[model samples]
Target chain A: MQLTQFLSRRRAQKAESRSPLFSFLYSRKIAPYLFVSPFILSVLVLYLYPFYSAIQMSFQRVLPGQVFYVGLENYERVMNPIFFRALQNTSIYVVLTVILLTVLPLMLALILNHRLTRWSNFFRAAIFIPALTSVVVAGTIFRLIFGESDQALANQVLSFIGFSPLDWRYEAWTAMFLMVAMATWRWLGVNVIYFLAALQTVNNDLTEAASMDGANALQRFRHVTLPAIKPIIVFLVTITIINGFRMFEESYVLWESSSPGYIGLTVVRYIYREGIQNNALGFGAAVGIILLAIIFVVSMIQLYLTGAFKKEH
Target chain B: MVHGRQDKLISAGLLAILIGFAFLSLFPVLSLLVASLSPASDLMRYGLAPELFFSSFDLENYRVIFGPEGSRYWTWYLNSIIVSSMLIALSLFFSSMVGYALAMYEFPGKRFIFIMVLLVLMIPFEIMMLPLFQLVITLGLIDTYFGTILPLIVAPVAVFFFRQYSLGLPKEVMEAARVDGCTEYGIFFRIMVPLMLPSFAAMAIFQGLISWNNFLWPLLVLRSNDMLTLPIGLATLLTPYGTNYQLLFAGAMLSIVPIVILFLVFQRYFIAGLMSGSVKG
Candidate 1:
């Protein structure tokens, strides 16, 4: 009551002593612009300008202090066999990682969310500890663990299981497996967090109703929990796909310089090699533009199929 | 009785599976810690094996990192701290302001700005790094902290997150503040910011982890030895000549300490904030 009276008194005197400039500056019309200007200016200068320049550079041949308009030559050059190999490898990694990350984390989240589960918080935090480490750190450790020597942890495990040790990095499938495994180990806990949060939103009464109707646990989850968390699933899948396309540090730190035979070369690694290492900025920018287009198209299609664009009242 | 038995059996199986996964998740870090502690010669001879019983542990690697040889490591560590701190502070302040403005005020271009945020969020930094590198060079910000922090200081993810978070805030307090003769700026800083503490805490950890573990952009911009961040510096240890397994292991182990502390401190807010961003979006 006192607060209300104080507010009323202040409101009564609100516009009393304002000069014209002060009134204009403090008006609703101008306040939002003031609040949003910093973000707008940064976006314009930093993001949009660089994006525009990337488009321009994609059509030219860039050298230090000189640029030539080569008119699609750079893009044409980026369409070679090496580029195709990177695309194929990246696509395979993306497909495998996305599927594994989504399905595995969902299963884990389900397990953790079980009513009788003990030490769920401990397990969650333990699993999440890996996500706190940098990719470089994780990649470096994985490299040593999966090293080509017989003494490496992976080989030791294999030999202990009565199997011959395999060179984990030289082959295509094995290298892809190693990359996917590293990504899963790092990301699984984080995804579980997403799933757990989504699971919490599933209505308990609805699940209880389904159970009362003689539905088994799987049936209840399928009919009740899955639909409730469908949005979160879609969001995770989309971002995972995006992250898959942007896979760089994993492959880079694993191989240290270059993946042998380019077996693990990702599209971003290709960009870094061409643009930064090899000094072919135009070609790199062209690849980057292609990657951007692919991600944009894939995301739009995924969102559309998932009804992300559909209006919800 | 039969149904209850089956349920217990299933729960037991699930518990077993969760334990296995949690073990798998932590095994790598345990091995890394072990590798960091073991003698470098043993690591080189055996290649980070699981048999930890026979090896002698020592602090030689950590001592080297702290000694004169590891002075550059500390420099990189300090650089990462400065960059991540500045990035988190500036980005949260500005991004939250924009988010608040969009959420609370009925302004022109609000939808356009929000759309722009989404578009920027979708475009991966890898695509932009090439052109951004050129811009950094042109602006003479190469090898500087400003260049490293400038492009990402107003991250679109943070903006979108803050915007989503701000929408759920109570508006009655703002109305009261306004009637109480508070200016719009005064209201946001004094009234709204306190309400959005959870969002800030969440974004801080999220952005903190990103900037701390960031390798590519910082690698591109920070050319000097002293300017490199922890990830970049640790990465350079794996030169083609030979790998510095000892320093690499110890440094990586230490590199994780700050973030682990941050996570433990803000563990609740981190997950809650992440959920709010995705679930609402």
Candidate 2:
């Protein structure tokens, strides 16, 4: 009887101290959902809904207020010669840029990791400053640097080196070269940072052991460092490819979307022209879907090849 | 001693190469600064020739940009600040909440939500822009700040980062808080939030950078001059006829200042954030 009376008094005290609002809010079963509902709501409205709408829009001819289903017509139109040209151009850019991005930064990171200079941090920071600048800014500066006149900096450098001045944006090849140069300049430092971080985790003792086993410096690097940083390399390559597909700002700023004969046009640039500029929403949706398909397939292949898909038990 | 001699020679060579690369990397940026400083008369006559050292340098371009004629520039900068601050706040609040729930609770649809986050992370903004533009139009958010920031407020990257970080947090403390009659929100706010300072700092920088540098989406939605962000405003300066190279260069240089300041202040967190976010895959 004494224990029961004490328990009842304690329960009454607990109830008196709890506010109704606090009790409602503190419910474990309900609180987690409330905490997470905002994100879930955003995902549904922003991502999932639009994602589904894009697929639906791809099948229909959408006007300002009217929409009608047109069954694969948009996809068929997206396969026109212009789309093919974009696909081919983007593929070329991806291959060349990926190679340069992967190789150059790896070399820079390896040298920095060797502690060759006391100013490594300063150099890293300086190189990374460009990466911070917006593509609009970088593109504008590059345009001026590679401007049309002989007085331009790039042309001046060429004349100084005894080479004739070339109009960089006038020709398709030269314009493409300018795009690649800008991308390499902007992204090299970012990739170097990635490689540097990965290098920090690499086991130095393994390298020393390899050297002691009569391995040359080149052999040691190939055997020790390359394998250790392979995952990062693969990851950077995939990003480079993705960036290559989405190469809008670089090319768009270098030359307008409607550059001379569509020489510098990229896939995303094409989408911008057809969709926003031309008001062909259905067509744009179809192109976006195609681009999505390409990226999804290539990324899955990348993951598989890099063993990124390997299940960890 | 001979081995030491070889090592010194190799180091010297490597240092020279690194220095050369750094010069190459910074040359264009330096040239942009030089262009911004070039006198308006020189820029008008000589046409943005950074190679021409004989031209006089002045801050007249910057003066013009910051002066009365540059009200547009200031407006755009203010818009960016407001948009990015709101973005950082909203993103940090909701993403961290969702991430915390994912990490702590075993509710239904957790795996599905996690997978959705990952899928959304892989889908670049360009792929989603068309339909998203349509949605924004339908919602009548065009020309509004909320429209500019709404779609990106709950960044999948932030959610993933917070979730990964929270998975490492001590679960025992949460259990103890429960036993002490503390509410779930109370534990998260009073206990877990204090523990998650580094993650918050990292996400702040990342989200801040994205919001500040975001261009393509803002360009699409923001039509009015007053509502324009910095990137879009600067992009308009590069018109096809009679481009104002001096003003443009000055504006570009000014645009980089805020981000550089952010980097200088939170560089360690920035590097930590990048390393963890990038190489973890």
List of clashing residue pairs for candidate 2: none
Question: Which digits, one per residue and each the tens of the lDDT, describe model 2 over residues B135-189?
Answer: 8888999988999998898888888888888888899998876666556776788
Per-residue lDDT tens digits for candidate 2, residues A174-218, read 988988888899889888999999998788999889989999989
Instruction: Give the C-alpha lDDT of model 2.
Output: 0.82
The alpha-carbon deviation from the true structure for residue B127 of candidate 2, after best TM-score superposition, in angstroms, is: 1.6
lDDT of 1 by residue, A1-313 (tens): 5675576456435643556777677777899998889889988888888899899999989877888999989888888999999999999998998899999999999888988798899999998899899988898778778878898888999999999998888898899999999999999999999999889899999999999999988899889999899989898999999999999988988787888899989999999999999999999999999999998898899899988899874
**Alpha carbon lDDT at B200, candidate 2:** 93
- Which regions of candidate 1 fall more than 4 Å away from where they truly are? A1-23, A307-313, B41-46
How do the residues B185-273 of candidate 1 rate in per-residue lDDT, one tens digit apiece? Answer: 77888678988998999888888888998888888899999999999988987543555666787888999987888788889977865
List pairs with backbone clashes in candidate 1. Answer: none
DockQ for all models: 0.61, 0.52
